[model samples]
Target: MTIATTGEADALPEILTERRGAVQWVIFNRPKARNAITPWMEDRLIEICREVDADPAVKALVLTGAAGDKPAFMAGADLSCLQSVKTPEDYTILEDRAETAAMALEAVRVPTIAALAGACVGEGALLAACCDVRIATPSVRFGFPIARTVGNCLSIKNLARLAAILGTARTKEMIFSARLLTADDLAGAGALRGVVPDDDLTERTQELAEELAGLAPLTLWTTREALRRWRDHGLPADGDADLLRLCYLSADYQEGIAAFLEKRRPVWVGQ
Candidate 1:
């Protein structure tokens, strides 16, 4: 069943939900923007996560991008939205929404799978990292190119998440390089469960999701929760604000956004 959204008749919802047997699929549908997520989409995603968690019949939750000429799980946050964020407060609000959405998905009771195809960068990559398993096509390109494109920084919690999956050194390199990592790279790092051919992506993801759905739910839930707790064990409750403020409230960040919109190279002057 498709969830209806309020918008122009020809406009598609930013998020779409489909239920097939015991697997629930949540799709990012803004193909025109390379499926860049918006605030509305984040809200919808949180709602879907809650729905999936409350429904015992849903054995697996699969997240993917709607097919397009250029497939993208999610390119990142909508540039238009990011362009509007100018203050540390604005960035904080945005980060909070994103964090809530990610946490909701991570807290789901059943197994979660990310079926990735094309570009999965920035917020997209973070969401993918939240999944219990990621199955991708060879064409997938995943990373946070913020240093080169957005001049923004990831929250400490986000860094921890990536470090947990890819290790501290790899995560630092991924951000520092400002380049998208290939599916093979991620698979080698053990970040992805598997990488399949583009043609076999859907079939392989379905097979894996179904296989996971057949597992003991309690065992899966216990493992997921335990790992999450372990990851958060030593995390600090405060102290990232200065780091975020330094980036978000800088001239360089605005220049980065302007340059990106203008299709020109950003001239970063470390402020």
Candidate 2:
């Protein structure tokens, strides 16, 4: 269902939300762009998380991309948007919003599930990791491909989130190799709760959401909160800022952006 949100009236909303029984479904709606996130979408997502948290009636939250022949839970952040962020100040602002959005999703009071398909890379992968459970189709391609496509780095918080699910070794290997992890890869790592056929994704997700919705809410919330605190116990207030600057401020980053837009290989040189 189309949600009436504050945005340009002429343009389609990048994010759409629907209520299915006690479950709230949040769909990333920009199918033409493979649902790559823009700053505005991130803001909307944060708002949705807040709304869900405030509503006691909402028992579960499910996030997914719009249906299409080539679906993407989210390809990543929009490159066109990232291209505009050239300075450290701009990058900081961008990361701040993204981190806020991710944290918001992680802190949702209801059980969260990611109904993933196709590309779920970079920021998309990180956000999916924030979900309490993930169910994907065979078409799922998950990982951080920044090393090959963007030449940018993830913040320490994002790394920790991934590491928590995929383990530190696989996480490091994922970034270093720049290879997209398939459904089997994620399922084997215990990151994906289940992998179903592409056609059954929606039905399966709804069934799982309904089951979770029937459980004791306080128990679910407590378990989620406990794990979150355990994962975040030692995280510093300032996390990998220098590393973010090193990559976002580098010449190779600019080259990567240009090459990606131009459909060419990025010639990366450590700056």
- Could you give the C-alpha RMSD of every candidate to the true structure, in order shown? 2.7, 3.0
The candidate that achieves the highest lDDT relative to the unseen native structure:
2
| Candidate 2 lDDT | 0.89
User: Runs in model 1 with CA error above 4 Å?
Assistant: 1-10
For candidate 2, lDDT tens digit of each residue in 1-271? 3322223321667888889999999988877777899999999999999999889889999999886558689999998888987997899899999999999999889999999999998789988999999999999999988888879898888888999999999999999999999999999999988999987888999999999999999999999899999988988888678889999999999999999999999998898
Give the worst 10-residue stretch by lDDT in candidate 2. Answer: 1-10
State how far residue 230 of model 1 sits from its true place (Å): 0.9
Clashes of 2: 0
Candidate 2 residue 205 Cα shift, in angstroms, is: 0.2
lDDT of each: 0.88, 0.89
Q: Over the stretch 1-271, how does candidate 1's per-residue lDDT look in tens digits? A: 3322223211767787888889999988887677899999999999998998789899999998877767789999999888888887798899999999999999988899999999999999999999999999989999998898879899888998999889999999999999899998999899998989877887788889899999999999999999999998887776698888899889999999999999889999997
TM-score of each: 0.95, 0.95
Error at 155, model 1, angstroms:
0.6
